[model samples]
Target: MKILHLETSSRNCSVSISEGKTLLSTCEEISESLNQSEKLHRFVEWALEGASLTLRDLDVISLGKGPGSYTGLRIGASAAKGFCFGLELPLVASESIATLAHPFLGKEYDVVIPLIDARRMEVYTAAYDGATGKVLEPTTNKILSENTFEKYQGKKILFVGDGAKKAQELLVQQDSTFLSEVYPSSRYLVDPAVERITLQQFEDVAYFEPFYLKDFHGVKKTK
Candidate 1:
């Protein structure tokens, strides 16, 4: 089952090709400018070319449905839908936060909290069980503070993703580890996407939309 994955919910523009749980290739760029709109197509082509496959060779399209950047998620969804439509393939999607935590799950930490910088002092995040990769806290846009993860204090927690840097300073936990360099990547979507495909949990390509928990709010006009 050759799959093409697109994850563009954060600053990173990521694309990958996978065969079931095995990753074949990835093309990613972490730009502060959030230029995913400019790089998504090229990344997709790069991933496919690197994997020595073409659009027609893909069996499914998996995407990072988001609670991150609205524009970035839209860019990724458009590209995924275009590919799925063009190739007549099925679409599988995963939460952007979960995708960021996938690679770190079941590692050393007892809990994993994946965070996406939501500008200012707020972050889009969720807590996952490190051992079983289960959600401990549902996705939310949290305003950072020393008491952010108050309930999970004293546990060995691993905070990951772009917003982890913000969390490191504010989330007061002596046992916490922070990996701020991590970002949601298409490669991590492989296993969950494959499982969804196996269970026929595919999205309706024609009507699918990114999981934006909130509406976009652009800069207000100043007169």
Candidate 2:
């Protein structure tokens, strides 16, 4: 089974192709000059061309449906939906938080917290149990403060995401292990896609949407 994965939930934009369990190709660009809307197609084309395949050869298209940048998520979702519709392939929606936390899967952490910056002091956060791959808490909008996650003091917590750097500064408690360096990517999007494909779990492309934890607050035009 050939799968195409797209991740644009953060500042970095990545595209990857996988054939069954093997990763065929990956292209990543981290630049403010190129937005996902403009860069995604080019990256996908490059991956397909490099792999000596075409969009028609893909069996599934997986996307990192996000809690990160609203515009980025929309661009990714739109592209995924378009490809699914055009190629008549199944659409797989992988959670952005889950994708970021995918690296810690099967580990022995009591809790895994994946955060995405939501601007200001707010973030899109979720808690997962690494041992069981169970989400202890569903994704939600949270504001960082000194008292955040204070109740889980004794438990072993591993924190990761683009927002981890800021979260680390506020989470001064001695109990938590802050992984401020981990960032989301297409590499993390593959395993979840494989799992979903094996389970025959597919999304309805027509009605599918990105998971933006908060309402988008972009600049309004004054006409």
Q: Give the clash count for model 1.
A: 0
Instruction: Please report the TM-score between candidate 1 and the true structure.
Output: 0.95
Q: Per-residue lDDT tens digits of candidate 1, residues 1-223?
A: 8999999998889999998889999999899899998899998889999999988899999999997889998998998898888889989999888888888887888999988898899999999999998889999998999997889987999998889897887777989889999888888888889889999999998899888887788888999
Return the top candidate by lDDT: 1
Candidate 1 residue 22 Cα shift, in angstroms, is: 1.7
lDDT of 2 by residue, 10-127 (tens): 8778999999768899988887553888889999999888778898899999999987888889899999989998888998888888877878867877788898888788888998
- What residue runs in model 2 are displaced by over 4 Å at the alpha carbon? 32-34, 221-223
Clashing pairs in 1: none
Local accuracy by lDDT, each model: 0.89, 0.85
TM-score of 2: 0.90
Best of the candidates, TM-score: 1
